[model samples]
Target: MSFNNANGGRQLTDLLIIGAGPYGISLAAHAKAHCLTYTLLGYPMHFWKHQMPQNMFIRTHPDSVYLSDPHESFTLLRFAAESGIDLPVPLPRPLFVDYATWFAARTGVRFTPEHVLQLSRTADGYEAVTEGGGVYTARHAVIATGLQHYSYIPDTYDGLPPGLVSHTFALTDFRPFAGKQVAVIGSGQSAWEAAALLHMAGSDAELIYRRDAANYREGQSGSELIQLGETFFDLPLEQKREKQVQPPGSAAAFLRPYVEGKIRETGNAVVQKAEAVDGGKLRLELSNGETRLFDHLVSASGYRIDIGRVPFLEQRLLELLEREDDGNGRYPKLDAHFMSSLPGLYIAGPLASYSHGPAFRFIAGVRKACRSIIPRIVRSMAHARSGSS
Candidate 1:
């Protein structure tokens, strides 16, 4: 999908999607069903790019987590039909990825393997450039790049240099840290997985958290937040008008007490709570005032919505991506459908998680995600077509 050089009013494609994960695939299938002109460009299931280690099970039930189709054709159950693996049950990670590849091939979805450097609006719509010598344009663009790209690596470790510190997402194994002291920050799965791999690889590790143990639970905290919002935050007037847009409650909940708990359970790991990283060290400046140093620090702190960090967003659009509050660094204010303040721009997956409710990060969210935005795209398409190109 190359740029349309001619003067533009209503650009080329009716829709163009970036980051071809499950979110992008679902949208492509939706577009096809609606007979809309759209193109999906990116590595399909790119989130799986960082290969999961040797023996980790999929956190979700395979029956519930589907890739492209709404039902029947591309279901994981169908893939299991051949392998003799049980359907409606969780399958191994390797099998899940293989199913996604098979689904993509069968559906004729174009999965371009490229790293997008930036996304900016052209007169025609949006133009995306790659690190390689490739550029493309679309009338409307959707960002579904999953949650792995951006991370919440604290600046405290920025000056440490190289092997001494890293984000949890960047590491695959902890064998190199064997016999070395390493600190794993955050209470999520990424943090847990890092610590587990470290222990398996024979590293001395401690998993630290900023929250109390009471806050941890099985299932998501969103259920509690949603109920609490009804009494405090969600006003009758707002509920009457459907003001229940997403605003961050529980992310990474399914991983339990989270990935951190599992790692902490490992014999080689210690649980350090109410502490945060101060400079290059873990400073326990809470109910327990202790300080310790480690040879390496891994931040599994997750991500924050910083429009400024987004490569594709232009400066003007960046301003629009910020929430109304005094720049705590959120995203462009969006509709329930994940449509940005800018016209003809939509977002899916992690970037729109705050506005799309707790399920935005999972495959289970696909049906609702596609439903919310497709109608808007269809209506907008009529108007877009009447204009120019």
Candidate 2:
């Protein structure tokens, strides 16, 4: 469908997808199959292409990397066969990005490469202002921006200068720190992997966490979790929370062997305090009654969902949407259809995990989210059209 008006005026579409990640791409593919006029905005796989370290590997299995579509025709397996690649268990980041790009092309999903700078409500629907001076109107809007935007740095590093500290999301290359001593904070997959990657690049890297010990597990096939599907959404909130919380200091079993003898690991230790020492170094006081200095710090501490951090959302819309009373108001309270309290606005991907279930946090959840969200959008549009007629 033609998105722009023939006279080159403001474009109008039935649906506006605000990201080009797995969630956004999946949603757009479903919408196209359903014959809905939609506009997708954002660079495809922006985070994976620019933010992630080039040598890093994803924790998800190859079976879980497929972007969802109505027919399920495009999958990582098919891509691997067509592209003549022997897919690995722990997929490399570059391969996954390539697969996503191929999926988009094969599915005929096209997107405008500009990001929405501001999204505000209009009388008929929603209006989005793009960074490239483009305006588009849609009867419905879905936000699928992934986790990179929500990278979380703990308050403990507040005193350190920005030059000396960075979240893993911000550091794409480790060669600069080749001869320097670096400390990676957190015990999760990202933390451990960052430390290992830094050490591999000649940095004297150390992994530090507040847990008693690192929790390493065998490679996950993700079939069981994928089977859970909607059943996870049926559980009680407290139960869902229990299943969602990953063990402190958790890393994939394969990572242990790679990082073992190469990186120093300290457990049951928290950065109680930090200060900038002379010669551009950081002095950190640990909870275990130890003091140390490092040339740099990487807060692999991971992301926390806070809708307020989404810069494109306008103030009025932000205040109007209902948020879950989960103490921190980190997630939007969504219904069974993934629609937010504000009508015609939907949220997916990790941002929807709190309300839908923890499964939404992974790429495996993309199909489930598309199945729920696309049909709801179609039904809502039909209802609106009949009423207008």
Candidate 3:
């Protein structure tokens, strides 16, 4: 079912995908392969290119980072072999971005480079309005925006003046903090890695965390869990939750030697309070009663997924959808096929993790998500067409 929109006459398609990251691009590729109409919108790999720190290495294995297509013709191994580049163990961010760009080109996945401002329910389906005033209508809409909009910062440091405090998501360069005292907060891989990067950039960087000690996953590879595919999803909820919450401070084992002497680690501590002081420095009061001064503070506190935080989703649409609370947070309730309570709407990527299991949080999960969702969408489109005829 296709129609020209009244607003600027944009063509309507069967599926409207709202993001252009791994999940969104993978879904579009599958839709195209299945002969389904889809309109994919967003800048390709925007978060990786702009948000992530330069020269950073991801914990996910190089073998697990490929964007999915129906034929699996564009895997990372294929890209590396064809391009004559050797694959690194812990993939570098820039190299993975290059592979994504190459995969999109190889699969012919073209996307609109526009920010979607609003998404609301239409009479026949869902409608999305882009920043450029373009309208997109489709029988089904998939939300695969990923973690870009969900950066989480603790409220304790809220009183610190602007420019004195920033989240890791907002920072890509550490050169600005060179020769300055910097405090990096959180216990995740991101936090530890950011501190290491800052130290390498010549900052007197200290890693602060509330955990007793940094927990490094020495021999474990996430690819093992990712390879489980649907088997992991079938685990009991308790088991799933246990796997979902990686120990705070858990980072790739290889990083331990690289970052050990470069950055100082202050465990079992958190910044209880912070205030701006003279010369634009921040005075932080630690929970352990130690007061310290730093030129800047970086919150590597990671992200909290909440559909309400997504600006593009209209309030009415948010209200109509059902949600699932996983003890730690609430997420959209999704069915086996990744469909939300709203019949024609679906959720994917990290947002679908609560219902589909934790694998959806990484690029490795894209194949499974697309595999489950695309067939359901194909059937829905066929049923809609038959009814209309």
Q: Which predicted model would earn the best TM-score? A: 2
Give per-model TM-scores: 0.75, 0.95, 0.93
> What are the per-residue Cα lDDT tens digits for candidate 3 across 128-197?
8988798888888999988988888888877677799989885888999999999998888888788888
lDDT of 2 by residue, 1-389 (tens): 11222222366688989988889989999998999988888888887799888787887788766889998999999999999989987888899999888888888887877788999999878888887788888889999888867888888788678899989885888899999999998888889888888988899998889888888987777776666656677888778778777555578988887798888889999999988999999998999999999999999888887899999999999999999878888789998888999999999988888887667777767988899999998998889889999
Judged by lDDT against the true structure, how good is candidate 3? 0.83
Q: Which run of 10 residues does model 2 get worst, by summed lDDT?
A: 1-10
Q: Which stretches of candidate 1 lie over 4 Å from their true place?
A: 1-11, 51-54, 68-73, 87-91, 155-158, 210-287, 291-293, 320-329, 383-389
Pairs in steric clash, model 2: none
Error of 3 at 23 (Å): 0.7
lDDT of each: 0.61, 0.85, 0.83
Residue 371 error for model 1, in Å?
2.1
Question: What is the clash count for each candidate, in the order shown?
Answer: 5, 0, 1
Best by lDDT: 2
Candidate 2: which stretches are off by over 4 Å?
Answer: 1-8
- List the candidates ranked by lDDT, beginning with the highest: 2, 3, 1
